[model samples]
Target: MGHAADRRPGTRVDRMMTVPAAVSRSDRASATREAILNAAERLFAEEGLFAVSNRRVSEAAGQGNNAAVGYHFGTKTDLVRAIAHRHNGPIERTRARMVAEVGETDDTRAWLACMVRPVTDHLADLGRPTWFARFSVQAMADPGYHRLMAEESLSSSSLRRALHGLQASTPHLTREVGEERREMFRHLVLNVCAVRERELAEGEPTRWPTWDDTATGLIDALYGLMTAPMTPIGTIRR
Candidate 1:
């Protein structure tokens, strides 16, 4: 009985010792993964979709060999997908929260900020606005990335639901035209913001305008144009 008891302690110690080593390995792997993602984000943003290679990502990540990208993520597509996925979660959650917060407000201004704040704040938090911003523009322009974005982003049903909720919350937007136009205007805002981001990163003179100005201008113009009664196109010859 004593012999068995003595062996029990040794067995427990063996198990306990293995855990920290396993945990340490896991921590190392996690750190490596973050490094790889950070490097990939920069390269993809600066160079565009096709410009960045798996080998370059690995090298920039400080990994020892080409196997790292494959070993960790299996493929270039998978790695970029992972990076996008990682950012997408927080973004979606923030948007959802803002949507909910605006639920009680009757003002469309509050609702408008709810829809746009998440995006602007996300870019602000990234600190390297150029990285995610450029990637976003590329995604918007590239059919492949657009499909990927649609897949990862809120589903159509979810978007409609959110829009319906927003319409319900904002009493000023009663007509179908108002609601539909608002949604289209929101998309326009996203498009303009993406273009501005790309221009800023390309070292072009952004002194022509600011992102916020462009954003607000787009939203205002859209709101006015969509809400205003339509005039006959050819009749407005003046």
Candidate 2:
């Protein structure tokens, strides 16, 4: 039976609310839990949550048995959350700090950059954890997984709030234009992120694509088309 089955069904509510009485044993248990989470994060990123087994996570983490996953996190969903929390925690802190610094500034660009850069920079620096990135892409493609991710570690409200703040600060953005343009921009950015792993596997990137490169050209063309209506379309049409 899965570790989830072992938990009493609906009887014990509010698990996180209970503070375990401090004891020497519990301290060791907590440390073991952290190690498992760390190992899970690394392995999950490389092998993907679906591809990796709990046993593998246990072994990678130096926990000799599968019970470690269940001992710390009751379900796979909980494990995913622990991984996301670790990955996103620093980015969240950096974003908060950036927001505070940009709070009094009149620049919308800075605010927007602050909002987008942290996540992208982390992914770029770390290189997509193969497993995690695959899982993310798969989740995006599959409705059930998408919902699972949304329920577990995802929140759209904060991103929406950031966009709203940018709209408020930026004078040129009309409601319709901002909504359309921002949506397209975000979609493009996400595509770039999702494709990075594939790009790395194909070969080393040397320079920016020449105009002949279809992918780059297509994106550039779409960017221009999307922005065209926002500015002087008639003058530029000819």
Candidate 3:
């Protein structure tokens, strides 16, 4: 048997200390990563996504090592995806709840609300001075980064369900017209939200009083756009 002195609590205490030490390092790394993500999103939103550099992001994040971005996130595209993912989870949950509420409905406005409200609700939950809306617009506008945004968006099962519901509600639209209107809806929502986000960030008055109102306006406009009569291709003069 070991002597009492040899078996004293020193070894046990030392072992216990290791856990918190490891946790502290992990906490610090996570905090650093968050900082880098916030800085990168803001920079990307303010400047064009292609115009901003990883080194600039790191510097804005207050990292002394300019390579901190590259070390934490592999590439610019990876960093943008990470920023998107941070917000996507909450938005997805909200959309899932909305979809559940309006299950298998042919109501066009209901489907449009499901598609629009989740996003605006998320923005509202984020409070003012958010960068995500602007960052998303920048990503969607860029050819190189557009696919990344689309992939992240399509990965949401709730969004897919909402879109299917929308399509079913508007059976009058031919496949080509449906596709064209879908693009229009995407541009309208993103650009409108981006404008609202910029105005909020700049402390300027917004055209719509609230996010809910903005969502309502979008749904109304989309309903008109989707239900509009299609012009015959042959009737147009080239």
Q: Weakest 10 consecutive residues, lDDT, candidate 3?
A: 1-10
**lDDT, each prediction:** 0.68, 0.59, 0.93
Clashing pairs in 1: none
Evaluation by lDDT, superior candidate among 1 and 3: 3
lDDT of 2 by residue, 119-172 (tens): 555565564343344445554444545566655433533454555566676556
How well is each residue in 1-238 modelled by candidate 1, as lDDT tens digits? 3443333445876778778988999999999999999898888877777777899999999998877988999987788689778877666777777666655555555555655656666765665455665666666566657667656655533345455655665555547656567757656766666666767667676533655565466656654644466444467555
Q: Return the clash pairs for model 3, or none.
A: none
By TM-score, how accurate is candidate 1?
Answer: 0.71
Model 3, residue 111: displacement in angstroms?
0.6
Q: TM-scores of all models?
A: 0.71, 0.56, 0.94
Backbone clashes for every candidate come to 0, 4, 0
Candidate 2 C-alpha error for residue 171, in Å: 8.9
lDDT by residue (tens digit), candidate 3, 7-104: 33468766587779889999999999999999999999999799999999999999999999999998998999999999999999999999999987
Q: After superposition, how far is residue 42 of candidate 3 from its true place, in Å?
A: 0.4
Report how far residue 193 has shifted in candidate 3, in Å: 0.5
TM-score (C-alpha) between model 3 and the true structure: 0.94
